[model samples]
Target chain A: MTFVTITFFLFLAVAFLCYFVMPKQHRWLVLLAFSIAFYLFAGWEKFLFVLASALIAYLVGRKGTKSSLVFGIVSIVLLLFYAKAGNSILAAFQMKESIIVPLGISYYSFSIIGYMLDVYYKKIECEKNFFAFLLYMIYFPQILEGPIPRYKKLAPQLMEGHEFSYERFCFGAQRALWGYFKKLVIADRIALYTGEVFSNYKDYSGIYFFVAVLLSSLQLYTDFSGCMDIALGVSQCFGITLDENFRRPFFSKNAAEFWRRWHITLGTWFKDYVYMHLAIHPKLLKLSKLAKDKVGKRFGKSLITIIPLAVVWLLTGLWHGTGADYILWGCYWGIIIILSTVFAKEWKQVNQFLKIDGNSKGFSRFQMIRTFFVFSGARLLTAPGDLKVSAYMFRHMFSLWSFREFFTKGALVGILSVWDVVIVIIGTLILWKVDLLQEQGVEIRKKIGQYPIPLRWVFYYGLFFATLVFGIYGPGYQASDFVYIQF
Target chain B: MEEEILELLSAEFPEVDFTASDELVDDGLLDSLTITGIIATLSMEYDIEIPYEEIIEENFNSIAGLASMVERLQEN
Candidate 1:
């Protein structure tokens, strides 16, 4: 069940009650049962996929054989590909086409692969117990959209019995409420405009297209990061800490740093497992040497770095999908990152020549805004359909720029109501204020906790009711699924 | 070896005092970009193929750590 659903909350309540009432040693078993039950609710067929993944990881990790490791990883990769592109692959082979994407197969397959690699490399010991392994692999809260927990990071916590703490419960409840606020109040509300404007790009031009594209980017962030917050908050109730996925990524000064802060676990996974390995491969080393001989030391070495980065980006693109638009989106960011690095020296020189103080607050703010637009522009490639639509939208956006259209009745009324606009503006301001406070190292929760009980309850109840009243739902609006869950 | 590593680090990260700081990675004195550059330079300068497994914090967090890792790799 989705995080926003009433059924999921009921399930969580039952699971939490069962977990706490059980014996300390048997608590983990309860968690495993709940995890399996959660997966089963999605689909029994999908349940088998996760079970197979857990089994494969455990067997390969336990065996610790070289050939088995290779076999396991390759098998897992193929399974992932099937989950991602099974229909197309079947069609290619002239078989009956069926969409067989197992729920969370893409996410958990990576977790299993990572576990097997770590086992083979002897980074962490193999988890001998099957149930413990399954519990870690298919933890219900993070099973769907993940922070992609590592075995070393998550397994022990899963196995260790946690005594319920009132403080932990409060924290988790508040965090989950905040996550709902972001998803329901901000992302779902904005998705309407983005969904309309992007799907009907021809009908809208100039300022509308740009506004829609920017909203899409914001919606993506809020939705995905909101999912992570819910996952983390749920896990926190059990005293399990998942990795932080977003770190105020909008404040990033460049595309490279933006990536480092966004979907952090996925980036690090590729870095540690894929990029680093490819960067130091013998073939790449040969290429590096050749470049160094042909060109100079710095540029050649930069080429060496770019080669692996390109591979990472390509895989990253394919990881999202086999779609042309997805590949283009990946390449767009890859080129931006590569250009930033290639022109590092020249950019610095230009800044100095232009008497731009790189450290000034104004400069930093300018960089943040510039990075936001760059990221937002890149996200246009992720619009519905192929690159052609994005191209047309871009052409229209730049070629037909008009200030008056942004304020025109057609522009505002076609997508959102005046009330919706007001709500979105206020919601965004609240989100930014909270994020800014957190960025300044303010422990907001703790600060609130220190307040008198009446004040604290007032704040909590205010947020809870605000989420209830202002959240977009019922009647015409369906609970919008998180953006990253498709991947 | 420490002095040589310090020299290399200083050459790459001209702003940082590598000699004074021990928690270079921890303190954010050395980010991944700088770390990658150092790895390339060290691999080239010392003719050692630093494996992916060796790219851990303990191996590159400080001047001594880097020098010790290089020495150990050389011996191997």
Candidate 2:
């Protein structure tokens, strides 16, 4: 069920009631049953696929053997590959693929794989209790788009019996409502304008395409982070704390920092499972040492760091989708970050020679704006269906760089007006400001709560009204699925 | 004994000043990933496999705790 839908609210209400009323020890059972029922409601046919996968993982994990662990890992990987690429494989065989990728299969498969790997490596003990394992894998809130809870982070919480707390509930509900505002009101509305321009990019000129790129970036952030807020908020209602996903990504002065802030869980997952492992490989270490001895520490560190980053980005590109544009987008960011690091010393030298203050507030602000534009331009490649169209879009973007044509013109006027742009800017600023505060270890809500109740209530009511009036809801415009769900 | 482990810790994390009585896990001195790295290193250096159950914070509370565990494993 869509998090924004009435059916989801109903399910949550029922689950909440049952969860609180149930015996303390059996609270997990209540959640497990509700989760299963929720998944079944969403996609009953696919329930069997999820169930079979979960069971296979559980059995393999419980019955420990080196070979069993290897087999389990292989089986999970194969299932994911088939789920992801089954149609292409079927076409090659001259058969129409009957396999429907279960809703949330991409997400839960990672959870299952991570769990099995942890167990295999003996990093974490296997959960012999089938229900506990199921709950960890299928918790409804995160089943869709995950913070991708590790086994250790989630399993103990499921085992702990939580007494209902009014404070926790209030906090969760407020956060959920805030998420709704972001997703339905801000993100979906912005999407309308971005979708219009991007879908017809061939007809737009310089500034128009530029605006579209900016709007698309904002829309994606709001939609994905909004979904994350709701998922995390819902999990909070049950006192199951999921990891924070997005920080103030836009505030990042560099692409590397941007990755650290955006989709944080996924970045860390790649770091732990992929990057760090490869970074510390004996071959790479030897190469790094050799470079350090030959070329000096400065050049060696840059080479070592940039090489691994390139590989990580390549994998990251392929992981997003089986498309060339995505690959280019990933490589593009990778190159940007590498260049930034490679030129760090030179950049400092140049800044010093030019007598420019790198620490000046105005200069920093300009750099941030420049970085945003550059990132947006790179992401424009992601909008098109293929590399050819993407290349055409890029060519047109540069070729038709007339300020008058963009401001005066055809496709731009039809897509976004001044008011829409204003709203998007305001919304993005608010999100960035909030994330910045949180990153600095400020307790935003707590500080807000210190205000007079009447003021707090006013703020709350204003948020609610804004959402209700502006939220993109009606027939024929389905809530777009969370982008990370496909991963 | 704890001082020895602290020396190792100091070598790995130059910024950290390890104390024998410090609550390493609770103070966030060691994150889960770091813990995994430590376990892997301990196994290789000391030729001891730490069972999953032994990974609890009680056995890794301080340098002394880890050293004691390592000593026990060596004896075994």
Best by TM-score: 1
Residue A475 CA displacement from its true place in model 1, Å? 4.2
Candidate models: Cα lDDT each = 0.85, 0.76
Question: What stretches of model 2 exceed 4 Å from their correct place?
Answer: A88-98, A286-307, A339-358, A401-413, A417-422, A436-441, B1-76
Q: What is the interface RMSD of candidate 1, in Å?
A: 1.8
What candidate 1 gets wrong by more than 4 Å, as runs, is: A89-96, A399-408, B12-16
Candidate 2 on A42-117: residue-level lDDT in tens?
Answer: 6787888888888989998998787887787788778777776677578779896467777777678777877886
TM-score per prediction, in order, is: 0.95, 0.83
Task: Chain A only: list TM-scores of all candidates.
Answer: 0.96, 0.90
The window of 10 residues in a row where model 1 chain A has the poorest summed lDDT is: A405-414
Candidate 1 TM-score, true structure as reference? 0.95
